[model samples]
Target: MVVVDVQNDFCEGGALAVAGGAAVAEGITRYLREHRAAYDVVAATQDWHIDPGPHFSDHPDFVTSWPVHCVAGTPGAELHPGLDTTGIDELFHKGEYADGYSGFEAHACGTGDAGAASSAASSAAGRPRDLARWLTDHGIEAIDVVGIATDHCVRATALDGARAGFAVTVLTDLTAGVAPDATERALAELADAGVTITDSGTPS
Candidate 1:
């Protein structure tokens, strides 16, 4: 499954926005148009949170309490209008409980029988399934990921996908940085860990 987090709150102008976030949507669209039939399923995750959730103040990683962003029902929480979600078959919402960063921790991947089953059998026990599990269950042995904020959620998801044993590839052109240096560092880390980084021109 291709995970896209091209939501307004992660885009150029919303709270906690990422520079070049708008480009992710367009790049993913182009990729999908070329390879829509290669997969059996497509899924996406949105950072759907509510105001005053524990995520807003519970973590020291946040510089200051962020103005509530991706709040449910808010314009900033909507998927960026530029994304072609018409190809997506499932939408998972994360950060509802404020413990999620990766899309695999989102509700659709987190609360199902597959999660329960995997939790019982794996050493990565008790962790939610998110996108990685969804892909594994559907017999997808590799993933080509593209989305917003390469240093944050995108990095987390790609790393987790690699750890989950899928051959993970990050489409660099279909992603944007949360911070240039940090994103570069994250990509380097992913590369060291065996996640392939490539432009959208690379075949899925």
Candidate 2:
């Protein structure tokens, strides 16, 4: 399972606050608890922007660029408190200096620390790998995705997963979108990409 950008900056009271973000965080934790055994491994992805050039905007238009958020090591970049990541085996951090939106763009870092760099000294396997590399190394060919901003990061991650030849499924109930219409369009795009659009109740 892949949890995408369930960080504080994406939730309520956050720099980029998505409505229902807090609810999605809690829902993901609950779903993980009751269905932990359904998947062999679980991982999470976080946006960890540093400089990111024009990705941060003073007069943000809300697309392509956004208000400064998920700055490295800041509380806003940390995972949401409502999310229980005890079952997560690894974490992938992305966008240290760019507009990265896909979990596939992330690199695995050892768990416990939020926004840890992909170049961290080690991971569960003693070396960091991009999401696709890590998953492939673990023999993972299919993935279930859930998390914040269904129209953005969530959508990107699922699409990339499919393109990488990993069967992908997005649990709609466990995600919050930046906008309703965008979310609807994202789901449609995912379905068209051959990604399974389903709910948490659907078995992996």
Candidate 3:
């Protein structure tokens, strides 16, 4: 399972706050607690930006560019408290110096962090670990994605997972999007690419 960008900056009071983002966080924790045995690996991605030149904007277009968020070494970049990440094995941090929208982007890597991300999630630091490579190494064949914004990073990550030849599924009930129309479009896009659109309650 892949949890994408459940950081403070994407939650309720975040810099790029998504409506219902915090609820999604809480819901994911509950799902993980109940369904932890359903998967072999539980990995997560965070948007840890550090001078992402054109990606961070003083006046964001809210499409290509966005307001500064998830900057390295700040409270906004930390994972949301609502997510109980006890089972996350490894963490990937992306968009350190460029605009990365996918967890597949290899900006940095970390292993083991306490619930404090206590799994040691990457944040513009740690050694790089290409996501596809990590999954391949673990012999992960299918993926279930859940997280903050359905329209952005979650979309990118699921698309990339499919392209990498994994049977990908996005647990929609565990995700929050930045906008409604965008969420609809994103789901359509994922469906077109053969990514399954489902809920956590469904058997995987």
Return the top candidate by lDDT: 2
Tell me the lDDT of model 1 at 33: 84
lDDT (tens digit, per residue) of candidate 1 on 1-204? 566578998888888787787777776777788888986777778888764455685344543245567887789988888788778766677877574567767745432334455445444654445566557667889887788768877888888888888898988888888668888999999999899998877342
Off by over 4 Å in 2: 112-127, 202-204
Evaluation by TM-score, superior candidate among 1 and 2: 2
Candidate 3 to truth, TM:
0.90
Candidate 3: 10-residue stretch with minimal lDDT? 114-123
Report the C-alpha lDDT of model 2 over 106-197, residue by residue, as the tens digit. 88765633335434534545766888987887789999999988999999999999999999999999999998999999999999999999
Q: In each prediction, how many residue pairs overlap at the backbone (N, C-alpha, C within less than 3 A)?
A: 2, 0, 7
Q: Estimated TM-score per prediction? A: 0.80, 0.91, 0.90
Taken over the whole model, the C-alpha lDDT of each candidate is 0.74, 0.89, 0.86
Q: Tens digits of per-residue lDDT for model 3 on 1-204? A: 999999999998999999998998899888998888988888888888888999988899988899999998799989899998788887788898988899889433555542234224423335445788777867899999999789999999999999999999999999999889999999999999999998888332
Q: Candidate order by lDDT, highest to lowest?
A: 2, 3, 1
Residue 138 lDDT in candidate 3 = 74
- The number of the candidate with the highest TM-score is 2
